[model samples]
Target: MRFIFLFTLISVSFLGFYNCKKQNDLIEQKIVDSLFYTQAEKSIIFSADSTTPFTCLSALDSQQLQILKKTSRNVKTNNDTTNYLVHRMYRTLFQNQGLTNLAAPEIGINRNIIIVQRLDKTGSPYELMINPKITQHSTSTTVYAETCITLPGAYPANVDRYNLIFVEYYDLQGVLHSEMIENQTAATVQHAMTHLGGGVLPLTIDPLAFTGQEIDSIMSDADSIPMRIFLTTIHSDSLILRKQSIDVRPDSNDLVLMTLIKRMRAALATTTGVGIAAPQVGINRNIIWVKRLDKTGKPFEVYLNPKIVMTSSNTILFNGDGCLSVPGVNGRTQRWAAVGIEYDLLDGTHHTEVVQGTSSTNFTAVIFQHEIDHLNGILFIDRIAKLLQTK
Candidate 1:
């Protein structure tokens, strides 16, 4: 009887422990799913495959470097902190599984070092570098932006980085590793180093003036001075109507794109028109704000790098199409009845969707083609000319 009783007690204890562990793991998975979804909604979150969305940061401890915080103070400059910094770098790399690289400062290590997982045509592999300094920078620059793990709430910014940089550094074993980095990698390294130097975006005259609240107010208040800057009219300039626009670079211009998107939406609210473009306000970037007539709210959607990749075989007559660029000049024009478009959303995700046109009076397809033409430097007047010529 004593033996049977002991066995029963042990089994009960083991079952309790097993159940507790299972519950803890389930809770952890929920947290991870929530974070991954949040990041996907707010920023340029990407994965090697669409199926795997969760990151390893959720399994890590609070003190781990993967957690976003002010990382400026953690970087060490000398050889004394090499072993500690390298260990921290590897830990950070492990914690941030999908990340291409990590900086020592990010993980709370006071050492000027970055661990990068690089792949080129030649394949140099994952390596560590210490005390990196930009010895030379190219005269030309590029606009790039990225989301940081630290500032989870903030959108990416249009940051200026050298197109090419000659960097001098030492490896993990204290050997020299000097190289010239160009293009995307150069931009990434420059962005990470900015964190080491204690710089963050909304680099403004008044720090308090640039918070999330202020931005919301600016976006919401249509008559505000900041909003007025984006207000354009037919008489704005020939450049506004004729200049071709370029794609807004995702590398460093995300904040600029966000601000422009907000202002464009606000500007559109004050007008009776259904659409607006970036060049209309003197910015030559390929962006447009348009009302979604098919949607219930009639919400304005921003499109970046928008292009009509496919169109229907049949043509439709747009009898009356006017523009904010040319007032009091409505004309009949020809357009594709159906269009398949690809554009970048605010979160930097690319999407392709088909907008179907009806034989009745649905103008969504017409509006998309119209705004997209503006990006390619085509005006409504040009369409009228083409129609007349074809006739």
Candidate 2:
């Protein structure tokens, strides 16, 4: 996506009235300066008119925060159910916050409903979770670095959590069912559950390692070098790599996302690898840059919130999968020969398409799956080890 610069526009009549107009201008400038912009020289997009309040916020306002913290009442089978109100909250969140999905408590609605939009790029699904609960969380814990759109100023912080969880919820038809969600999805559900309890703290550690001084150093050097220190397999930020990533706030987090796209492109240019994910650079957002080997002329592109819709029944065994994070190790892995994907382009457009692996060489499918796996904290090595355990 092209990065567009937005300058706040002031009205002539308002400017004509007061000696404090200049003072107000300075105040506005200060707010903008404190609020947005990454040290990497990234730019934020704002409205042409200064009179409009910022649509995206680094943190929720008093009203919004209060709503988010409110304990939601459960929906009933009767007409008094808060299902409709929950849906309204869902739409309002996307409209105002540009979030991909939200929990019941976050929208000031009944605790019985949650709306999740495109978590992946293929076809968008309007899935609803009515009266959802984590029936069980796997005893095995994994480290994850988490982030939230509500706390935009806070960086992703390391947290320990169950790698797998059994979630029981009602479908749209009001049928109760259970699904085993693992890896990154497990992390997401755990995070949302925290909100349900009216907890303001993210599922993260206090005094984040990458906060303050370390973050400052990284951003200061972002223009000159890739933030490779934050990528997967880095020993210091090990959990950060394995953690599931969150979606960027299209309205608020646009600048950092834009800068990430640029930096990833530049970093990939320096590497022989075909793709990279947001967590590779330490930003835990659901975005990835991949090389489209199946296409000509268009060498590489970015996918935001890509979803894997379908996988070919037939599978292919590749020689091995390698990663930038894992230095010299390549492990044999079986992957789908073809897959259907839904993802958003840089301009925030949705698309659904199929990617096929070559009969003779399945590198294309391998790369696509590999990069997408990063979003869920899955590395090729992890996949390889899992395969071995099954045998």
Please name the candidate that would achieve the greatest lDDT relative to the true structure: 2
Candidate 1 wrong stretches, greater than 4 Å: 1-236, 250-253, 358-361
Over 4 Å off, model 2 = 1-218, 222-224, 229-233, 250-253, 358-362
Global lDDT of each candidate? 0.61, 0.62
lDDT of 1 at 164: 94
Assess every candidate by TM-score: 0.44, 0.45
- What does the lDDT come to for candidate 2? 0.62
The sequence of per-residue lDDT tens digits that candidate 1 reaches over residues 101-171 is 66655544333567666543267455666667788999999876555544445454446788999987766
CA shift of 75, model 2, Å: 43
lDDT string, candidate 2, 1-391, tens digits: 0001122334324554675678667755564444332332121112123222223322346666765665553443222223344445555555655454566555343254565553433575545666677888889988776766667666666567798888887664556778887875676666666666665535433442334543454466555466663544457666878889766433223444565667777777788888888777766667788877777754888888887899999877677678877777887887888889988776767899898864434367778788888889888888777778888
